[model samples]
Target: MLHQQVFKLALLSNALLLSIGILQNPSLVQATPSYKASNSGVPTQSARLNDTLIIPGLRFGPITRTTTYQDLVKMFGASRLSDHDVFGAEGLSRLPGTKVNLGETRSFLVAWTNNSRTEVAEVRTTGSAWKTQQGIGVGTTLTELQRILGEFEIPGFGWDYGDVVRPKQGRKFKYNIPILYLSIDLKAAKRYPSDYRAVQGETTILSSDAHLKHLGIKVGEVRVYFDQPGMTSAE
Candidate 1:
């Protein structure tokens, strides 16, 4: 009986020691949450546009405005991409569109310069997950955008009748580029009569075209672009 009790005590002590060992293990104690992002305030790979800050001249998620196309490939792993030259600059500028996970954002466009593969000129995205620090995202309402971004202007033509807001601070004159593009869905315009009227008042085309007048209004997509050295007005 004594031997059996001693064996039982020894087994219990070993079990306790093993539990203590596990509790003291630094790896186990320091284990991080899988969902947390490496950079605080920076969004995770799966974070939505409004969930992260849109720091112009800085970065978006894992991609910085200055991050090169080659660097992107190295960071995100191999991705199928298409490359082209800037519309007017030709050889001077290279634009590469990559198919990578942009959370809820729809597109990822990067531009490089100096005829180099690693020179990143700009980064643009229409991802819904991409947003300004003010929480204005791709799907944010026009009223909300106007409220946060103040007055904005809409290009009279093009497939995107989105309004552009140039922020006065946080990356202003450093890059003479559109900070945020707020657009509405023409198809959904009829549903939002007030927004439809707002769009009509902003652009003459919508008001002039009787058929297009019926278009609806819902925040369409948002695009954020960085300014590079050689880019001209045509780009």
Candidate 2:
């Protein structure tokens, strides 16, 4: 009987010791798993969508008037951005710029104010992905533009500054102006000899011109310029 009592006391002591140890170190107990998500350093889908947005006179995705070449490298990585000479407006001369996405369908150009490339002068995209708030993008037809812009003018085709959309005087736009410029090119211009002849050259063609409606002219490029005072476009 005494041996049995001693054995019972030993068992109780062991249980008490275990309880004491657990009390002293509460971490000994299993804790509820906390599932914390970590970022893999890749941009999220929403972030990429924001980057593709073309906010006129303000931002092109993450790029702004103050965005630098180094900023481009950081945002898109050096592999996606490459040095290239982009043709200036009016085809005056080639200016230093960075080509984004290289040969991809999402390819775009960022022209700098100078060789320093410290400031963004313009952001041009032929890619259909970059679009304004009004859904006007590279592939938007001339008729669609007229419907949206409300009586805009188109420069004649077959020249350096040809096919550019110029807003008419006293015309009000749904959005702000002097920032977004669209270049409309008619790929089938050659097919319509009479229509092409009527609109080709350095003349200004009204958006409502009967010849232009059937020509199937579409916006080939979207250029966003930063040229206001205290802005980046100046030399």
lDDT of each: 0.43, 0.61
lDDT tens per residue, model 1, 1-235: 4433543353344334333443444342233223344344433445422234444343454555555655555544455355655432114334544445544554566656555655555555566666544576566765565465443334332322224443222121222122454455655665755545654432333223343334432245443343421110110
> How close is every model to the real structure, measured as TM-score?
0.51, 0.70
Full-model lDDT, candidate 1? 0.43
TM-score of 2: 0.70
Best by TM-score: 2
**RMSD per prediction, one decimal?**
23.4, 27.9
* Clashes per candidate, residues 3 or more apart or on different chains: 11, 1
Q: Where is model 2 more than 4 Å wrong at Cα? A: 1-46, 89-93, 177-187, 229-235
Model 2 residue 11 CA deviation (Å) reads 94
Clashing pairs in 2: 51-61
